[model samples]
Target: MSHGSSPSHLRGLAEVAAASVLWGTGGLAVQLIREHEAMSPVTISAWRMAIAAVVLLVALLAVRRAGELVELARSRPRQLLVVGAGTAAYQGFYFVSVTQVGVAVSTVVSLGLAPVLLTVAEAVRDRRPPAAGRLVVLVAALAGLLMVSVAGHASSTGPAPVAGVLLAIASGTTYALTTAAGGSISKESSPLVLTSGMTLVGAVVLLPCTALVDGPHVTTDAAALAWLAYLGVLTMALAYVLLYSGLRVVAPSTAVTASLVEPVTAAVVAAVVLGESLGPVAVVGILLVLGAVAGLGRPAAAAGPVLPDPDPVRPPTAP
Candidate 1:
């Protein structure tokens, strides 16, 4: 089979898409958790990372891979730190931006910008402009993202739009850089190990911030705890494992673009599960985003350097 049509490549695309869908569920989980507890976003995020790290570490130990995680930390400390800190920084900036500007602006500016940044970075790294087709996909996905995000929260403007936009930019930049760095690292490390270590690092980074922002309150409410567990295990832990595994075969730019599915999935979930109505424009935006991701799945567009699997005998597993 041709490179683009290889099982691994197609599997990678599916893995990334699946991860985005899982991420989409996080919004609902967060909303549910908030309904049951008065926790701030930062505190929730800290809990999410902490829970995911513990779960991942426990899995590693169960699989007799604890030593591998330690080796990863020992050998690639800087890269691991960068990935972990970047993950925490982007989410922190995004949450703060939401409070400062509003969800519509923060979501569009932060989530929408990462794909564009990664595409441009890829072009620069390759010393050639992005293919015309890739550019079209990027534009379509971004337009869809803007429409979906803005339509949902048209009147939800925050107190400081300027600061929010700046924070969103910081979030986007960090997200793009982190994706790039993670993709590179995945070429040499197990996705599970990498995710475990980075999540631990991210939890450590976010704990103090959560303490300062919301006093790090953990809800004893059963429903809230369940939702928090969903956010940590499904969204953070499994989703990231899939993301890193997908990064092994998919280009960083394409992977980020594929993740645009998250907002679309979120919109759909909100509409169906919460009985929130979606306007015609939002429906169209969902179509556009889905179309763009489908376009990216084309062999020509999806083609990328397929790195050697870290463990040929045991392929990266995704939940």
Candidate 2:
């Protein structure tokens, strides 16, 4: 890694961490929405994506960036669409995992698996093994993620843990692909443009599934609407913009590792808001996860972007 890229790498890590923190609050919001409105996971995801896309589009038009969206659509339509599909798959699988195994395990399985998958994929593509120190940090981060998540699993009796785990694995795979692809896509377009184009694609893919799963279920309650707005604006819109911006310079493995902060934030929120216990183990796990993230984001860990540049309209064909 070149020293010239160090600042960019650190910036990327910070952006990703900020996004993760926002995402940490998402589970609670989703739960609130479910309580207020009887909607399936798919339906909630649909609403989240669709509303977010609309919000981004409106903001773009308001700021005179609609032309950027149009240009990106024309220039990189296929890659953006692929990224959108991956985003939809990630959310769909994650929410389903949440319904089946509870939020803790779902979050653990999905987020935990992403860095490892990215590490392996990168190694394979680069034909070089990860550095010893980086590998150690990665393992430590994964362990801490598992510890925190398991400790947070106070309500393990949700549905089917096994099925949820599988779904969460799928979610992780999709998430990894999305993040890696985002890195490549960022090279071709700005984060705002990418977010606008990709979210539209995700909304298109998820709308039909939402309709089939929830069957015209709609709610206009103030609380439900509030939760939906939060999900759309914060979780979907802001978070994704941060994610893509980070990917512009962050290695996929480092980005994913830093994002383990999500579970830590989620745990603390659960303790304070949901009145769940953090326990000594969970607290220790939080420290470990944070430490690993810090290590991964340090100047020493700086590396070039994990993927090569290519046509934005191409299939997101490689890492």
Q: Model 1 over residues 1-319: C-alpha lDDT tens digits?
A: 2325666766888899999999988989998988889899899999999999999999999999898777777777888999999999999999999999998899899888888888777677779887667778888999999899988888999899999999999998999899999997887778898999999999999988876775338778999999999999999999999999999888887888899899899999999999999999899899999998887776555423344445543433322
TM, every model: 0.94, 0.90
- Model 1 lDDT vs. the true structure? 0.86
Could you list the CA RMSD of all candidates, in the order they appear? 3.3, 3.6
| Candidate-wise lDDT, in order | 0.86, 0.81
In model 2, the Cα lDDT at residue 189 comes to 77
Which residue segments of model 1 deviate by more than 4 Å?
1-4, 303-319
Q: Best-fitting candidate, measured by TM-score? A: 1
lDDT of candidate 2 over 1-319, digit per residue (tens): 4423356667778898999999889888878988888777688788888899999999898998787777777776777888999999998898888878887788778998899898888778889887776787888888889889888786575669899989999999999888888877787777777898888999999988865674346788899889988998998899989988888767777888888998899899989999988898899899899888888655454222333333434322233
RMSD value for candidate 1:
3.3
The backbone clash count of each candidate, in order, is 0, 0
Error of 1 at 147 (Å): 1.3
Runs off by more than 4 Å, candidate 2: 2-5, 158-162, 214-216, 302-319
